[model samples]
Target: MKKCPNCSADVEEVFELCWNCNYSFSEQKVIEIKDYTIQEGNREVNCLRCDIPLIFSGRYDFHEGARLGAWGNLFELFVNSERFDLYMCPKCGKVEFFIPLNDSEYKKS
Candidate 1:
């Protein structure tokens, strides 16, 4: 166990930041990730690159801090950081990310 420098709270050695105070042990800060997955049922989605069926993975509501990552920068996370539906291709390892339809859209579908 390790003590946090800022809060003096006990933290596990495996983790760099203090879970209680969110203190950064390193120069980089930790980003918060929130999951907002909705059941889309068994929808058939295919990968464009490999032409293989995609598997429904999970969903997430990324915060502004996490939006600073590599792929996060590509999307307009700064302006619009909405919920995303994640899909993965088992063969080519391609990830398909898109915004899930809201309640109104779901009714239309």
Candidate 2:
């Protein structure tokens, strides 16, 4: 593992970018980052661990037999192409799932 010169975080040898601080090893500088978190009306989302705004990663349709965990999907009836909003923390790579807040098409399971 190589230590990041900017943040002093240990990065894996094969990676060119530092995941913790967004430092580019080949360029020898920190990269500029933009916040692309899609904000919903009166509904703000943030990472619980990193406290950073979560970036919107588009909606997804989970089909039947999708393995979310050993116990299975969160909404059992969501197999019918109902979409869920996906958000992720850029720094920590933590992902979060949310039901669309402003969408009227969202159905209750």
Candidate 3:
């Protein structure tokens, strides 16, 4: 359910942007939602000072669990079985990460 190329409103697929004019759909639709579960791989971390090549972005779960406590009435069933890959280094934000089954250079396309 994503249709807001720029004002065509009705966008809410965990929106990246576009709140009716804030369009930012650079086309990145890798959706496989049947209750949530997508895990791809490609890890080779290295960029803490200058070593490049850090890519491994895949692992998201939302199968009816994610409401956190405090007035929100906790509800974190099935939590996360370890799935995080979001590295960034836009020049200096230098960030590194690797957690794909224990980072043995994860490679599961």
Best by lDDT: 2
lDDT of 3: 0.55
Model 2 TM-score, all chains together: 0.43
Clashing pairs in 1: none
lDDT of 2 by residue, 28-67 (tens): 9999876544345224678999999888888776655565
After superposing candidate 1, which stretches have Cα over 4 Å from the reference?
A: 1-41, 66-80, 102-109
Clashes of 1: 0
Model 3 misplaced stretches (Cα beyond 4 Å) = 1-51, 55-74, 78-82, 90-99, 103-109
- Regions of model 2 farther than 4 Å from truth: 1-43, 65-81, 106-109
Score every model by TM-score: 0.42, 0.43, 0.22
- TM-score preference between candidates 1 and 3, better one: 1
Q: How far is candidate 3 from the true structure (C-alpha RMSD, Å)?
A: 14.2
Query: What are the lDDT figures for the candidates, one per model?
Result: 0.69, 0.78, 0.55
- For candidate 2, the lDDT comes to 0.78
